[model samples]
Target: MAFDYDDNNIFAKILRGEIPNNTVAENDVALAFRDIAPKAPVHVLVIPKGKYVSFDDFSANASDAEIAGFSRLCAEVCAKEGVGLDAGNAGFRAITNAGPDGVQEVPHYHLHIMGGRMMGPMVLLRD
Candidate 1:
């Protein structure tokens, strides 16, 4: 599938500072913030400052610095939020949903950090 960046997307607006967010951490290449609709006790989102429709798109198009910075910011945010390795072996879950099947609600690529409690299996098994 072709990945196109949409300037009008909500994340793009947030990156542009056109919309305010509950920012957790931010650097030159990325921003981390509390998810408005959190699925876990500690839920945060890390997004690239640039336009990226999916993880694949970001990984393929973004510069090495951008990729590295974005990754570092994700770990930094998780640590700052108290879900770091010190929190226990469970650590935290950093996930990115891609495409329609993944239920990606936004067009921009983002990582969701979830922790602070035990999580169930990634998917439900159907008979």
Candidate 2:
């Protein structure tokens, strides 16, 4: 399946140096930076430097090295932000929204790492 990647998206722009970000950590395959509109005290966004529309798109096509590098970068961000289990307090939440149903604001594949406080329930029960 073809993944439609918009080169003009915000993440894409950030990757191309068209926009600036408070970079937390970065490597050859991914970049981790603070979120502009943070929902948590330590809200960081991790995205692949390569073009990807969503999690599945990345999972289906990312090279093994890309996956390893991206994962390592995320771990580095967590440690840098003091939000990982080994860092101190409680752990952080790693999230990735997919499509419209998931309220994905950006078209690029990214992970949101939130912590620094009690996050409460993962999702409200919709009954």
Candidate 3:
């Protein structure tokens, strides 16, 4: 579905307490919630608290602290969810689709972290 970009994105609304979500984690700079449509058992969408139209927008507007916070938050969430670093040899996949051409259904920049089960290779449309 094409994400609504005119109004504040759904995720941003969620962040602003204007909407509800199955939140998994939250920090000053980001929020993590379950994907409405999950591709894996533990699929969560990690979104920046700050609103950005797209990945490119985020890249341009995000500060070093924002970038570092996002990186650390990913690791922290993965560990907390026991998705990759648990004793079970389980692993996780983190994905972020950039633009419409990249399959980004949402205009808001977010990261998808999937785990609680093993996943296949990173190749897309490959044998």
* Residue 18 displacement in candidate 2 (angstroms): 0.8
Q: List the residue pairs that clash in candidate 2.
A: none
Candidate 1 residue-wise lDDT, 3-101, digit = tens: 577789999998888999999999999999999999999999999988889999899999999999998998888779888996564677889989887
Q: Tell me which residue pairs clash in candidate 1.
A: none
Specify the highest-TM-score model's number: 2
Model 3 steric clash pairs: none
Greater TM-score among 1 and 2 belongs to: 2
User: Is 1 or 3 the stronger prediction by lDDT?
Assistant: 1
- Candidate 1 yields a Cα-based lDDT of 0.89
TM agreement with the true structure for every prediction: 0.92, 0.93, 0.83
Quote the RMSD, in angstroms, for model 2: 1.8
Distance from true location, Cα of 63 in model 2, Å: 0.2
Backbone clashes under 3 angstroms, per model: 0, 0, 0
* Candidates' C-alpha lDDT: 0.89, 0.91, 0.79
lDDT of 3 by residue, 57-97 (tens): 77888988887787778777887788866556468898888
Model 3 per-residue lDDT at 17 = 88
